[model samples]
Target: MIEFSNISKSYGSVQAVEHINLKVEKGELFGLIGPDGAGKTTLIRMLTTLLLADEGNVLFSGKDVVKDYLYVRNNVGYMPGTFSLYQDLSVEENLNFFATAFGTTVKANYHLIEPIYVQLEPFKKRRAGALSGGMKQKLALCCALIHKPEILVLDEPTTGVDAVSRKEFWEMLQGLKAEGLTIFVSTPYMDEATMCDRIALIQDGHILDTDTPTGIVAKFNYTLLALTGKYKQETIELLRSMEQVKNAFPFGDSIHITLRNGYSVKEIEGLLQKNSVAYEKLEPAKPVIEDCFMDLMTSH
Candidate 1:
């Protein structure tokens, strides 16, 4: 439903995005996964017709985003990263306002947003700013879906919400996807990437890898060791100093170490013992999206 061909964007000397070629098929839930300043917002803005690219074309449903911007705007539902609703407006008022602005009525498209709006029904008269973070999130989503657009573009929708709310938000998205809504969502959370049908791992304004969650993990071609014990900081420093160690960084309570070819796990253990760097567990670790992302980032 969306395609970015050789897309590049810049602000002065800094390139926010570069040579980004991506495709989000119709009815597919595509994720743009990256950390802050990785250009996810810039890319989304360009796709949503809110910003123009420095080079290349952005097409939405086969229409040029530059020339056919009006159509794109009407056909795409956008929920920006921040809470952009009017603070003084009541929850129902916000939804009605958006629906009216789009030349539609709340009742006309109620079915499209019913699942999400139902959760906010009890607070229909509550002022938007007075609502909790999770409640505000639901209100924004309802407003976005008020028009029943062809695609939904969410930019870091779960950034500041609580864990339970984040989980609920993804569940809502899955329900939307099941209803055949083409969804293009960006997030800084690696765990959220797994929920998408496919994802593009981006960093430093460049795409590192784009694949299904499992596909991306399968491409991690290295021996990963998870080491957990005392002197965690010392163990990381020691691992980085070794010529055979390609990358070593903290992962949760353990330190994930990737080694170069010809480096054995036993050799690492022996070296740690030789240096008296005590460790309780040091074993091969399974690769995850974050691990793959870090590897791609450091390798570049």
Candidate 2:
């Protein structure tokens, strides 16, 4: 339902996004996965008609976004990365305001937001700023859906929310997707990439890879190993120093390492023992999205 063709944007000398060619099919939940400052917001703004690109074109349902911005705005529901609702207004008032601005009423499209608004009904009279992070997210989403747009575009909707709230938000999105709404969401969380039907890993204003989560992980060409040791920093440094190790980086409480050709886990174990590295575990590990992303980032 959305397409970006050779899209490029910049702010002064720093490029926000460059030559980005992407497509989001109708009714598909597509994710743009990357870290902060990876240009996800810039691309979303251009797609939502809030910002213009420096070069190339964006199309919504085959209509040029630049030439038919009004249609794009009317059909696309956008929830910005930051909470952009009025802090002083009551939840009901805020929802009504956005609904009226879109030439609609809350009553007219209550069905579209009922599932989410039901959770916010008790606090409908409260000021928006007083709501918890999760509640504020629900309110913003309600406003975004108040107009009953065809496509929902969320920019880092779970950035600062708690883990449970984040999980709830994704569940709500799944419910929305089941309603056949085309969802294009961006997130910095690597684990969230697995929740999407497909994802594009982006960095440094470029797309590293675009595929299903499994497909992306399958692209990892090296044998990976995970080890937990008392000397976490020393273990990582030691692995990086070895010729048989391609790369080593700390992941959570363990260090994830990729081995070079002909290098075996036994060899690594022998080295750790030889160096008197007090490691409790050393075993082959499955490659994850982050690993694939890191590999792609390094290779690119």
Candidate 3:
């Protein structure tokens, strides 16, 4: 439903996005996974017709986003990365305002947002600014869905939401997908990448890889040795110094090490024992999205 053909964007001397080319199929939940300043919002703005690309084309349903901006704008529901609603307006008023702006009434699309709106109904009288983060999140989502656009573009929607709210938000997205809404969501959270149908791992304004979560993990060609110990940093430095270790980085409470020479597991354990690094655990593990992401970033 969306396509970017060699798209690039820049701000003065710095490039925000670089030659991005990707497609989003109908009813597909696609993720733009990256950290802050990774150019996700820049790309989203082009897709939403809010910003023009420095080069190339952004097409939505075969319509050029620049020359045919009205169609793109009218067909998309965009929730930006930041909270931008009127702080003084009550939740219900904010929803009504957006719905009216789209030439529709909230009542007309009540079925579309009922699941999410029901949660915000209790806080209907509360001013948007006075609502908690999670409540504000729900309210924003309701307003976005009030018009029932063909595509939904969420830019880091769960950035500051609590764990429970984050989980709720993803659940709502899944429900929306089942209703046949094409969603283009971005997030800096690595764990959320697995929740989407497919994801593009972006960094430094470059797309490292785009694939299903499992496919990305399968692309990891090295053996991952997850090591946890009291001396975590020391173990990582030692592993990095070893000629056999190609990449060594800390992940969570464990240090993930990749081997260059395909040495035996016994050999690794022997080396650690000889060095007396005092590790609590060292073992091979299946590759995850974060591991694949780090591997891609480091290699790039």
Candidate 4:
């Protein structure tokens, strides 16, 4: 239920976001996947009416974000990357405060946040500053949902949390989606991109591609090879120097290599063997979203 049409934002001589356009359907869980300094937060701010775009318009539920800022603010709930809750305020107090600000009470919308709030109930008396990363996240989410807004906009909600907490948060998001709340989440994690209904991979203030995770992977035209051996760094360097190589990137314990035009997998293996690389494990792999993302970034 959100639309950004050719939106552009700038500060001084640098442009944070440029000519951006996107649409989030009602009840859809949309994701913006990008690394740091990729204009994700800048875009979110513009969409939430916290920051104005220099060009184009942001509309929420058919209302102009700039002209109906108050209406948008009342309809959308935003959770910033960092915890913005009052450090001294207890979890429950913070929740109550936000509920009151939105002309409601925590109890009034308790059912909406029950799934997330039950996890934070034990820490209700603890100061927000004293809560763990995951607890703080749940508390912030509770506050965001306290008003039962139609749309939820979260920016890097799992950045610093542990893996378990991150998984739990995603599960909670899935639960919220089942309730028909439109969610727009931004994350640096490529794996999380698969969790969304559709994602836009962004870099350098530009959108590289926007599609379903499986669709993006399927669009990778090049054959991929995963190579691992005794010498990892040397293998990477050798692959980069090879004329047959189109792209080579280290992914975890293996190096992923793509062949150039007119090159074949057998030729690549022959070349590696001729160089005495002592490679053991070598196999073709289906392209993943991260691989697509890396290729897109390298090509650009």
Candidate 5:
């Protein structure tokens, strides 16, 4: 339902987004994965009609976003990274306010936000500032969905929330996707990238890669080995110094190491033994989305 063609946006001399061409299929949950300052917010703003692109064009349902901004705004629900709700406004009041601004009423669309609103009902009379981080997030989501817009555009919806809240929020999004809502969400968390139908890995104001999370992981063209020993730090240093190692990074208790071209698992085991690294566990592991992302970034 959304299409961006070579879209480029700049702030004076600084280019926040460069030549971004992307498409979000109808009823698909698409994710943008990147770190901070990766142009995710800028791209989302352009798509939501909050910012104009300097080059190329953005189309929402075939309508130019710059030219048909009001129409696009009416059809899309946007929740920025920050909590933009009024601090003094009660939960119900904020919901009503947003709905009214869109020429709708909370009562008219209660069913649409019932799942999210149920969590906020107890705090309906409480001011938004009084709610916890998770509760505030739910309240903001309720306000965003109160109007029942056709498309949902959320920018880093789970940035600073707790782990449990983050999990709950994603589950809620999955529920929305089942209802056929087109979702375009951005997040810096690589783990969340796997939750989307498809994800675009963005970096340095450019798209590194875009594909299904599983597909991207499958494309990782290296045999990954994880090593854990008493001296983890020393092991990482040793692996990095090895001529047969291409990329070595510490992942939790194990060090994920990539072998250089023309190297075999037997060769790696021999090398580790020759170095006297005293490793206790060594095993081959599959590449995850983050691993693929790191490989892509380093290659670029």
Candidate 6:
């Protein structure tokens, strides 16, 4: 278990994170979802004892992170956002180095990494720098798990990887969670938020909201509709001009309109037709995590 109380961090007068308080249950997959400058990395560093929080306390399994930094470090595996592995070493050699540092060997904890290592064994002789993005990711994850730590802290592990590799990485994490490992990960992709048991949306050093995917979507207090057709931007501009439209923005190839009170499907459709907008389709659309996050960021 990991717990933090009123934890905050800053660089000079700039606040990186502020008053963050949360707990991660054993064997649960938790996520921190946000964009690049949302302070996810700062909070992760503090939790792993790499960066000290100027206020509050962080505890892991009843052990304070500051007071028991070394002991806590031994019980956790941390993978920063940047690729920090030995570039000159072979995939096999890199694993050996980390295992030795933890006073263990790959053979000792081979079972923990069997599923991931199976794919990497073919590239065992390849230098860390020679591996592809997906291969590098797998190698990094394998090295982090070499010690069989109780919890894994990964920061943006799939940032530059291909779509297929990103999907595979999340699948591997699900396997780890089933083996009773607490997984705490951060990602900028809002679509990935639904994969976790619970998620906290952060922006500008503050947590906007924390809840399950469905719970977050339930908080969106508006009737959402997807509009896709010719003159998409014009349709958005038209919707934006109406006082009844609560929100209007482009979502992929479609425009998402949030209708206000008294503006139902009929009124919106009539207005669009009056403006000579050729909409191929317009229908009620359910809100997702992205929609909820945007609302929180704007209203709060």
lDDT of 1 by residue, 1-300 (tens): 899999999999999999999999999999999999999999999989999999999999999999999999899999999999999999989998999999999999999889898899999999999999999999999999999999999999999999999999999999999999999999999989889999999998899999999999999989999998755677788899998899999988889999888889999998988998887899999989998998899999
lDDT per residue, candidate 3, 236-299, as tens digits? 8888888778788878888888876558567778888899879888889888888888888988
> Which predicted model would earn the best TM-score?
1
Q: Of models 4 and 5, which has the larger lDDT? A: 4
Alpha carbon deviation, residue 23, candidate 6 (Å):
1.5
Misplaced by over 4 Å in model 1 are none
lDDT of 4 by residue, 25-137 (tens): 99988999999999999999988888999999998999999999999999889999889999999998999999999999988889999988888888889999999998899
In model 6, where do residues sit more than 4 Å from their true spots?
230-238
Give candidate 5 misplaced runs (Cα > 4 Å): 230-238, 273-278
> Please, what are the lDDT tens digits per residue for candidate 2 over residues 1-300?
999999999999999999999999998899999999999999999999999999999998788989999999988899999999999999999999999999999999999999999999999999999999999999999999999888899999999999999999999999999999999999999999988999999998899988988999887889999997665577778899999998888888888888887989999999988998887889899999988887788768
Positional deviation of 114 in candidate 5, in angstroms?
Answer: 0.3
Model 6 per-residue lDDT at 82: 90
Error of 3 at 91 (Å): 0.9
lDDT of 4 at 83: 96
TM-score of each: 0.97, 0.96, 0.96, 0.96, 0.94, 0.94
Q: Clash pairs of candidate 5?
A: none
Among all candidates shown, the one with the greatest lDDT: 1
How far residue 16's Cα lies from its native spot in candidate 3, in Å, is 1.9
Give me the overall lDDT of model 5. Answer: 0.90
lDDT (Cα) of model 3: 0.90
Candidate 5 total steric clashes? 0
Which 10-residue window of candidate 3 scores lowest in summed lDDT? Answer: 259-268
- lDDT (Cα, tens digit) per residue for candidate 5, span 66-94: 99998998988899999989999998889
